[model samples]
Target chain A: MQRNSKLSEMAEVKLLGVLPSPYVYRVIWALKLKGIPYEFVKENLSNKSPLLLKCNPVHKKIPVLVHGEKSVCESMIIVEYINEVWPQNPLLPNDLHERAVTRFWSKFADDKGSSVLKIFRTREDEMEQVKKEILEMLQAIEDHGLGDKKFFGGDQIGIADIAFGSVIHWLTVMEEGILGAKLLEAHKFPRLYSWLKNFQQAPVIKENLPDFEEAVAFYKGLREASLGRAASK
Target chain B: MQRNSKLSEMAEVKLLGVLPSPYVYRVIWALKLKGIPYEFVKENLSNKSPLLLKCNPVHKKIPVLVHGEKSVCESMIIVEYINEVWPQNPLLPNDLHERAVTRFWSKFADDKGSSVLKIFRTREDEMEQVKKEILEMLQAIEDHGLGDKKFFGGDQIGIADIAFGSVIHWLTVMEEGILGAKLLEAHKFPRLYSWLKNFQQAPVIKENLPDFEEAVAFYKGLREASLGRAASK
Candidate 1:
């Protein structure tokens, strides 16, 4: 973590998160995009810390961004806060209509993107339904969300792009590294497929994204451990 | 529906919604608060119109705010857009932290507030679980969301207040008119109960709110019709 000696005392940012969390990575990408320096506090999900419990009593969830005196929970909310606090690299567009559109897609991603993660835990009978749902989500993005633009906010990577990046990255991890599925085929969802490539290669995101193989291993270990417990019981 | 002859040509706001929808009311309250005139276009959700399909192809859900050439979908997003477009009665606070906190609760309402409605559709075996979920949601808000403030956004009723207003109102209608359940007991959740009164009696909200008896009838009719279909099937 880089410390700004001049302004370190005022806005000391600390992120409480587990490394493999797609939600946590959303905040990390936003903070890195704005060139903000923060301490990365690793949290154990199985044994949550007192600080995490104290700060986010309601949800007791990860990716709690504590800035100076106040703490903000929830990933996208934290991203929006970081954007507002440090308006250097604007996460949202300038035009008000564009901003509203940006928020629409961001909200869409938050609402629907998590279903792709269910692929990891799904039984054989339910995989098809989950896959169909995810494909429909991709179709929505391909048809209406991205319109021949470089990013969701266009030209510059914005909030919506970051919001989808985590989902796409994990989707890729599950597809290529674990399940070897072809849900996000270029032929079917060309625009979304291209958008994923663009999002992955974006400067800050490219550098900071967790290793694909590592995420695959992490998820695989989790599945096996859960299965082992089930067998033992 | 009020029309501003002067600004009608430029903005031309049209709300596509059903009157009984709690989500639709959220957008209506925000628009009325800002004193923005809009044409209310009633939608029969049973047979969705081509206009609704064209405007919101993705979700095809209601509370679509069509402003001239642009259309914004999703209720809370529409509310936020209204606040941004017409900055008259500000929906969000000036302070950044307060704004983020407000968004947090608003998201919480969007995520959790719907469980109370599940009571209407819930079977006898599932009623206890659904009731428990709603109670937990109410307790969270009572404990952390409202801290003796007149509104969630402070003295003024803002975005968070509007976000919760719909949920709280629907919960009351179900409890008082339909279920007769003692879920929101004043002794249990005193702050939230008072906040509901404050929210319901607020200037624009008081006048614009749908009739409680009518809403009860609508929901009851809906439940009976669905049950009839289930029984026949």
Candidate 2:
């Protein structure tokens, strides 16, 4: 914890999170985009840490970014905080209306972008139902969210893209490995499918995203453990 | 629709919302406090207006604030948009960390504060479970969300207070009227109960909050209709 001293004028960022987490990855990409250097502490979610608990007492969830002496929790909030603190490569748009639209999609990302949780908990008999829900969510974003723009906000990658990166880019890894299904079937959602490629190919995003094979292996283990817990209970 | 023209540049704030909606009230209170004048177009929730659908195509719900031709959806997002567009009576905090903390509470208000939705839909068999969940949600806020401050941010009103207004103050109205249950029993949640009093008495809040008896009657009707629909289905 670097107290606000003259020497500590420079923001010292320390990110507390677990890997293969889209929420965690969102923060990672935001930091990398702004080119803010930080130390990343991978946590053991099962055991938890005192620092993690102390940083986020309410939820005690991860992706807590400690800047100077303060901790910013929640991934999108952290990203926004990072953007405000370092406004170099502006993650959000310039126009007030565009900024509001970016927020609308950002909230959508949290509300609907968190579809992976529902997908993970899908019942064996209700697989089709869950798939339908996921597809509808994807389709809505594909049709309205992306349009024919290169990114969600057109030309540049902004908040909405960062918001969906975890759900689309990272969770796609989970969908393929754990569920053995393709979430963004290119034919079904050409825009979203194309958007994912462009998002991954972005200079900062391409560099910051986690390793592909590692993510697949990690998600497979996570799904098995999650299912095993449900079965036991 | 006031396009972004100099002729209509007096912050043309038009709120599209339905009454007896705490979500709508959140935006109303924000606008009033900022002393921003605006027009209100009441909409029928069941039969939403084309303007409502067009503005919030994704959610298709209100309170949507159409500010200078651009529309902002999601109540808290609308409030934040208001804050950014009109920085008169600042709703959010100054410090970056405090802003993040304020956002965390706002998200908590959305994530946990909206537990009333689940409580309203609970079955007779799951009544106790739902009640316990609501209690736990309330207890977390009571224990942590408030201190010796006059409001959630401090002595002055902040975004968190506006965020929780829907859950604590307004939802309490619904809880007693619709559920025949008293959630904010003074003895059970002293902090929350006290906070609600201060929140309601704020100049902008007191004057702007919907008529009390009318809200009660409206909610009672809504709950009956909602439950009736659930039963028929």
Candidate 3:
């Protein structure tokens, strides 16, 4: 077993992630927030690279972080590992209960937030259902997730904030692609909307987000391809 | 906010879970193994109970275990919460690295095992692709997950075992429902196959599992409903 501190300084930290995945973005935001220098390896999901397959053979998915020879898979797990190794800018609260609450919301973001994409890919009727779900998701976050705190963990951005930051940012792009409108209506979700502006303006997040026009264009192409496939079927 | 031992004797333990969900079965197995008595609250997914919605307002999903006043959502998170609260029968390893590895596999199982269900629900041509994914998932587990151990954490049924146990058992029932077989063949994945048998026969797991026939019938109904909806479009 490798000791936590025994990781070699000479060894490089390599992150395997695909563009546009919120899971991948969480890791990037964490690394950037902590000022950790790392090499980013872009993965093509269609033709997965050999290293990605070997590193994460079980899932063969991205957001695999390799520190020394040991590789950790799953986005949140990787973030946890990074927190333990870095320990400088803490992403999780020190208190166990607070940590548990943060983890609960983080897990919620992961398991539920993916449904936002259904709005873009499904039929018109199904899109309406997805819209309802998205509104409910935003409402829950607005009510419980942020109770007048600047971030999910209060003063500073923590794991839960990072988790939702990716969702809200990417959802804006997806909302534009699917509906030609923003879903995080500023008036309806005032706290969440304000937090979104604050979050994107944070130094690490501000520097790392993908170009708006490029992301919008990419999702537009994806939407067209999915619609074309649905039409043929 | 609640202290650990305050609710130990005075509080009641209640589990809110859907009948057919494998995620829910994991909590049942864990609680049963610890000899902790609890009340069961079955949830209707279509019309969620007020308690279910109130307890897990973030996700509003099943497998929410309410201990005293606090409710924990997400299956593995709930299992970990159960382990922390109960501690009589340890579900995770003692060593930190082993614990991390166990967690790694548990997360892997949660993320990747859904492909088996995809195989059951997909079109005939798509079944082949899903089958390939299922085989890859099984192969990775057999090679890296089992490795000459009686269970995932060696001689004990830890979190990884329980996570995968639900998945492997449900895959068997799904195969029977679909009237097709490919992945988890004894000759191909002997280690995982044997582990599956051992996991099913474990005393707590054996007693808590839902009837195989009932599970098969339920899955069949689900499969037909999904296909019917798809065909209607």
Candidate 4:
């Protein structure tokens, strides 16, 4: 009886999410890195499941990790929670200063990285402004964040790397696949360009990334819908 | 020689900030709670200091904590760094799940709680909209955040309390001191009202709160200047 109970407890980890979402992908990569086995429950965003609503009552958003009776919300918070629960393949550094620096970059990614997606959803008239904003963000990362290090922390892809993986990956889809723009010029942001290459090629990240064609189609639809709604308005 | 070296190393903590700034106070309260001693370096917002610019080149913002040769930016991140370094007061819970929950609230406070400040700085035309946003934020806290607990972590004041400390305090300043309004009526937010009373009465925070009249005058002048510029435009 005790053994059965223990098994049930061990198997209770579940993730509530929709695929092709950068926020959800952050949690997925963190869990994969930790090698903690879990179930993935797909959520229909248009009609949110009762479980998702119950799990994340405040935000009512995806990437909610349900562990046993408790549910953790927010992508970066879930990533940190996973790192805390499973110590293997550590996402943050051991040194105090290095950990602080890692967190600073993580916070930066959470704050500014999402703005890049505006280009995917905004009109062509606003594309230049959004592109300029994304370029400045990439330049900051190039100049101050990822100097010569293969990843933000060092050789290993850690929290900061996962935080940015979704941004750069989706930016590629939006800029190259849909918009056919060249905002992330290698010459302008050589370090960022290299960092994205290394990040995408990282083992867990490479395998788990959304299919390129699928992601392009998904965001292209979203852009059309957004522009269509705006035109009518 | 070893004793002298240790003492000097211990005394190397320093804080860069401006007075009455909630972000800066969050770090101050955290450090005070941990009983960590540090020097406070005031920065002129009009003329940014070299040390402030040097310490936080990315944001060029205040509430930068300089420890030995390392500097940590962002208020809540600095607070977390302080908690990690000094585990005496225990800003975060020991349980992995509880810590995750605490972090969730901390992130929420960082993300949404700051919107309350918009009421203080916004023009009259936008006042109602900002007020509505703040009321919704407070309602979320009332409904989901604080129940009957003395604090977010129960009994002890933790990271989330410090995160919202500046927002609530400044809201009180803006509403009561300047606007002569009563947004945070006790009946509307019974738990939050009790929490604020308990929070303000807490040891480290009570002693460190900025003088009420001074904060009022400072923010009022800034608001007038903001409105003046908007009118001219």
Q: What TM-scores result for chain A when each predicted structure is judged separately against the true chain A?
A: 0.93, 0.93, 0.93, 0.94
Native contacts retained, all candidates in order: 0.78, 0.78, 0.23, 0.82
Runs of candidate 1 exceeding 4 Å displacement = A1-10, A230-233, B1-10
Docking class of 1: medium
Model 4: docking quality category: medium
Residue A40 displacement (Å), model 2: 1.1
Estimate every model's Cα lDDT from 0 to 1: 0.88, 0.82, 0.83, 0.87
Steric clash pairs (candidate 2): none
Q: How far is B30's C-alpha from truth in model 2 (Å)?
A: 0.9
lDDT of 2 by residue, B86-165 (tens): 79889887877778888888898988877675555566677777677778878988887787777878888888999888
- Candidate achieving the largest lDDT: 1
**Which residue pairs in model 3 clash with each other?**
none
Question: What lDDT score is found at residue A126 in candidate 2?
Answer: 69
Answer with 1 or 3, whichever has the higher TM-score: 1
Candidate 3 lDDT (Cα, whole model)? 0.83
DockQ of 1: 0.60
Error in Å for residue A60 of model 3: 3.8
**Highest TM-score among the candidates is held by which one?**
4
Per-model DockQ: 0.60, 0.64, 0.27, 0.63
The residue pairs that clash in candidate 1, if any, are none
Lowest summed-lDDT stretch of 10 residues in model 1 chain A? A1-10
For A1-233, candidate 4 gives per-residue lDDT tens digits of: 53333223365799999988999999999989988888999999899999999989899999999887778899999999888878889999887777899999999998998787787677778778888778888878888998789998888989999999888888898986567977888998999998988888888888899999999888988888888998899
